[model samples]
Target: MKEELSLVIAFDATSDAFAAEDVFRQNGLSGRLIPLPESISAGCGLAWRAESNLEKELTDALKSIDITSAHIYYLIL
Candidate 1:
């Protein structure tokens, strides 16, 4: 799992996740909004998968766009 590092981002709600997806796409962020991974949790039901290294940039971008209710988790896939 150490070889597969990914950043899983969760939103407060489905709409928040979708809004983040739109912002990510508009800003050229490399990631995809997918159903929440079972390994993470069953709650929320949606998440964004991205490279661990891009976390800072993504976080800043999201914040600049006024994106709220996001939680980032670094994990090995």
Candidate 2:
């Protein structure tokens, strides 16, 4: 299988991660909650994974949830 460059948003804490999940779910956004990639340990052990192009929208969603601090990374996985 081939991996593609993806957008992975790592939250600073579990609450932020869950909040993001909730916001995304309620808004019918794309992406899923995933274990933080081993290559990334910037924040909590949870991350949001989606197409790279979705970064802006995801960031906005996080903002809607009052998550102003998150680590955004582009990784191939």
The number of the candidate with the highest lDDT is 2
TM-score, model 1 to reference: 0.83
* lDDT, residue 40, model 1: 79
Q: Tens digit of lDDT per residue, candidate 1, span 19-76?
A: 8888888889998987887777875488999988988888887897687568889877
What residue pairs clash in candidate 2, if any at all? none
Worst 10 residues of 1 by lDDT: 35-44
After superposition on all C-alphas, the RMSD of every candidate to the true structure, in Å, is: 2.3, 1.8
Question: Candidate 2 at 20: error in angstroms?
Answer: 0.3
Q: Count the backbone clashes (under 3 Å) in each candidate.
A: 0, 0
- Model 1: lDDT equals 0.84
TM-score of each: 0.83, 0.88
